[model samples]
Target chain A: MSGAGEPEVRLLGSWASPFVLRVMVALRLKVVEYEMQQETLGNKSELLLRSNPVHKKIPVLLHNGKPISESLIIVQYIDEIWASTPAILPSDPYRRAVERFWGEYIGDKFSQVIRVLRGSVPGDKDKMAGEMFTALQYLEEAFVSCSQGKQYFGGDSISYLDIAAGSHLAWIKAVEKISGIKLLDEARFPNLFAWADRFCAHPAVVDVMPDPDKLVEFTVKHAAMCAPK
Target chain B: MSGAGEPEVRLLGSWASPFVLRVMVALRLKVVEYEMQQETLGNKSELLLRSNPVHKKIPVLLHNGKPISESLIIVQYIDEIWASTPAILPSDPYRRAVERFWGEYIGDKFSQVIRVLRGSVPGDKDKMAGEMFTALQYLEEAFVSCSQGKQYFGGDSISYLDIAAGSHLAWIKAVEKISGIKLLDEARFPNLFAWADRFCAHPAVVDVMPDPDKLVEFTVKHAAMCAPK
Candidate 1:
């Protein structure tokens, strides 16, 4: 019991990163008390480097000075370390695999949406937009199958899959605004839109997400900086 | 002990897939007997769809009725199920995290190499080759740091990281031959080169890998068929 009392949890993160937000949401959902150290990308703290030397990226979770990097891996680590809690993944093996499949699909396809936002040339932008539309169409189909009259990606409650997809909502909205294109057509994907709403409204998710207005401002400013002179 | 006498494991895979080869190597390493069903990409088998309905891709490892997908996840599942023998991952959390870091890094960077192989035009091929070379340089640096003075990626005895990276050797070699560009310079990255050789020679890896001559022949023939006219 005393051993449990002394275990320290620390998170190194930046506010703008959705990856960091995923870990934050998982910690909040698990009710794990942790210290947060906001890292500056320009002058990264030595602790962050020591924690995650290879990637040297933020969102490093330190459990008793043992660091785990990679946002998804950190989330899984949190779930494993704090096993006596509301499970973030399904108990059934097949269901857990299903959750993982959705998480990976989101990861693999979401980059195309970002690519479109990052594009400068009209032709390149159009090509990427078409790819984004195709990805969204696939997502619509997947969500229809996954939702199956459930409130969340993992069914009744928010799970890791929900966190994985929901974390990108801020970035997605940012890209939509920057590109002046609406990919998440509500009429076309009502269930997916509803799921996104429920996912955003979830207490754990809501608490950790970056301010939408600030995210939009950052995205627009960044886009302007990258725009052809 | 009698529980070990359960139904034989079955793998649904494509011969050319690096992902499938990872599972094949793992199964071989563990000395577990299994059946292999090669899946056709054009018309997937019903069992493949039934086993991994979400992703619907190889490789899916079916142990009795339970299906595990995602090559890395399947590797973990195999490690957990066969806990009585040689551990594929390090027991220490930090080391395990390091192993996973390399696994994810290889996965993230793999597409650059694939892109190089898939490029059509001379200019595009050259650009892709440069990208692949840069990615290989990073791998070389990583190998220098991680495998310094060690026989294997996990330091003696092929661990999951070795198996994960090893699966790509045939593809890498094939790409080199097909693209007429070699990224893994033996002079520049002796450790990585030696590691690759050792990985290929390992009995488990050696037994499961598609023959190198056949791999190069198939890849060259496939490239000709798929190349943009």
Candidate 2:
């Protein structure tokens, strides 16, 4: 743990969820030692439900015994608790707001991409593909403008924005295979593609990401089940 | 402002947006002195765009010239900056996390009702209504049960979660009128309906909610424009 007097941290999460991966990356980035418990969604442990009864979702981070749900909230809590090393967010308020804007944008916009890719019918595949492409286009524009040749989304060093966006990389790749629609085309989204490569290469992120091949397999199988006939 | 040495806080928002109303209610509950700027979406002011370039959507709160976007972010920022009487959030980390979970749930789940009510075709309307009903059922079962007969979402006193959920009352009513579907029936959702009434009665919320009749008129007109002939 980074803080000597602070309570020990524990994380409850599932291995395959991109949302769960986000918390893992933030903890690793902050160098906050935490006890990890892999949760099963089918039979969510009583403790997991008790800790986050409102959402009853995974990626719940418990500081001492006080649990914080939502991956972004957990990330902010981690930043607040561990203030020593490389700051994960910018100090300037405007810039911080900008980073947060991107975070919210991803949560609001790209989330739909995941939903569409997972649930799109064969007849509506083209429509879903278009939505995914539009989201990617927006992401590409944001990356090119905000990143400005930096290795990460928030700038030279990896910040929370990179962690936020990076968490989706494995899922995006998995969805590409499952849906058979490559929205993140290198020729079209060079900046986003390059950023994804750099994001996955980061030590903290690399250490936490689920196995890409297994993720692809799982997503493909799940998509087949959810796909509209 | 509640803070001893801080400058006044101002909110830029539209009267129709529930997201904006959340911030307004939070500010009122905190007793923060502020100004209001009603933004027109078609001709967004330079300040609104500059304050929130990425989304350019309101409920942007400016504190000492620094802007905070995202309704929940602005609420937390408001709570942190104005540490005066009648705390809008629980100080306990666990309770605070629970509050946040509900706040996020309202954003994620209830927001979908807008999309459902906006559906144009008969099949789309039925599908969306079914989904909206499912969402309402979940809230009635899970969220109302969790409230445990409290006056607010958190308990006796209002909290951030109450503001988040309460802001949707006008929109919910408007959508119900447009779609001829009432998910928030008084008998079926007694606790939720009563809570909405209490929420609107609260001085903080009462002062800022958009004119309900005007909101209904606007929504009906807008729906007509989008409805299939």
Candidate 3:
């Protein structure tokens, strides 16, 4: 629940969605209480449809009856609106741009390559996995630069990049389990592997993070659907 | 030629690239002075490569030697660092999210479909154009909501969405001429049609907008490269 005089907040989300998990973690980080309405897969809620007519997808963050779609945009909106302690993005413009650049890379490149590796898209699996590993190596370098040996990307605090990349940890792990592939190789990607561990263990993320076993089970069941046609 | 105490600013971009034009418009709107380094096609500069190592793409803005890549991110960084009048993004969090949503839609959906329509990628031309028109019509509705009958999506001022969408006007027009297809139909997309005209005529955009004739010629020359194999 919002504090007195605070506007109402609600999140339309699916329990197992990595995107939804991002919003949940952001909300928790901000300590902003809100209602969660679960959106069923295949049968999206009317509220979800009405809230995000364009994408018609979860998670949509509704503040005072207005909807904000897209996880990264929603997270930024939350940060700006709340404007309290524990800033999600860095205040410095350059740093913010760097974080955003990597965040986009995570969404656009890293995740897409992983989709192929996980058999969602028909492709040369080894080639796709190699691309994913290359991207991960780049992200490892990014973490080194951004963290400066700090625990998190934002240097001691979870950040936009952390949430953006960290949200996919479970899905990546599930892919590893299902495909028998080593993606986040400890020796090759020490920074990212350790960072993933720390990110999942973080207070704001732990409760909302998807269960690994459940993800593996879900991925196994959906393997046929995702298999290369 | 920044003012005293202003940081040294430079832009790495190609003259005809719509993405570069976006950053140019934003910089001009904020009245910021900067140097421009034109990058050649297929032959990128070491500065661009070093500055934006992750993507190694153009339209990189160097503010005091620190580089910011991605047109939208650079625009936001300009808006934030300058923090002057004629804001690129709305001050209200919700409005900002709205603009960001539309901006992403332009990049992710509208522009990709246009790529197909222009023969850049092999696809059903008619179907791709239909999708493009649908997206334009949706933008028309978005304009009605965001503009509130005002002249621009930002309500009387050009904004991030306007830049994101409007930057592609020349290419869209060139496609219409080259392919002999009528996109941006006045009858169907009245709001966007009118908005495009207004947007193109704006002082900040007019000077930097690509020449339609040049674009058509370029398209004709490159048509062979883009033809479906």
The top-ranked prediction according to TM-score is 3
- Candidate 3 lDDT tens digits, B34-86: 88999987789999999988788889998878889999999999999999899
lDDT of each: 0.77, 0.76, 0.87
Instruction: Write the residue-wise lDDT of candidate 1 on B27-145 in tens digits.
Output: 88888988888887568999898877657889998888677889988887777677756788777655677677778878656755664574433346666667666666766776666
DockQ metric for all predictions: 0.32, 0.28, 0.88
Question: Docking category for candidate 3?
Answer: high
- Candidate 1: give the clashing pairs: none
| Residue ranges of candidate 3 with Cα displaced over 4 Å | A1-7, A224-229, B1-7, B224-229
Task: Candidate 2: give the clashing pairs.
Answer: none
Q: lDDT, candidate 1, residue B161? A: 85
Over the stretch A49-72, how does candidate 1's per-residue lDDT look in tens digits?
887766899899988877789988
Candidate 2 lDDT tens digits, B140-210: 66456556767776677788878877888887777777777876888877777778788889898887777
lDDT of 2: 0.76
Q: Is the docking of candidate 1 incorrect, acceptable, medium or high quality?
A: acceptable
TM-score of each model's chain B: 0.88, 0.87, 0.92
Error of 1 at B191 (Å): 4.1
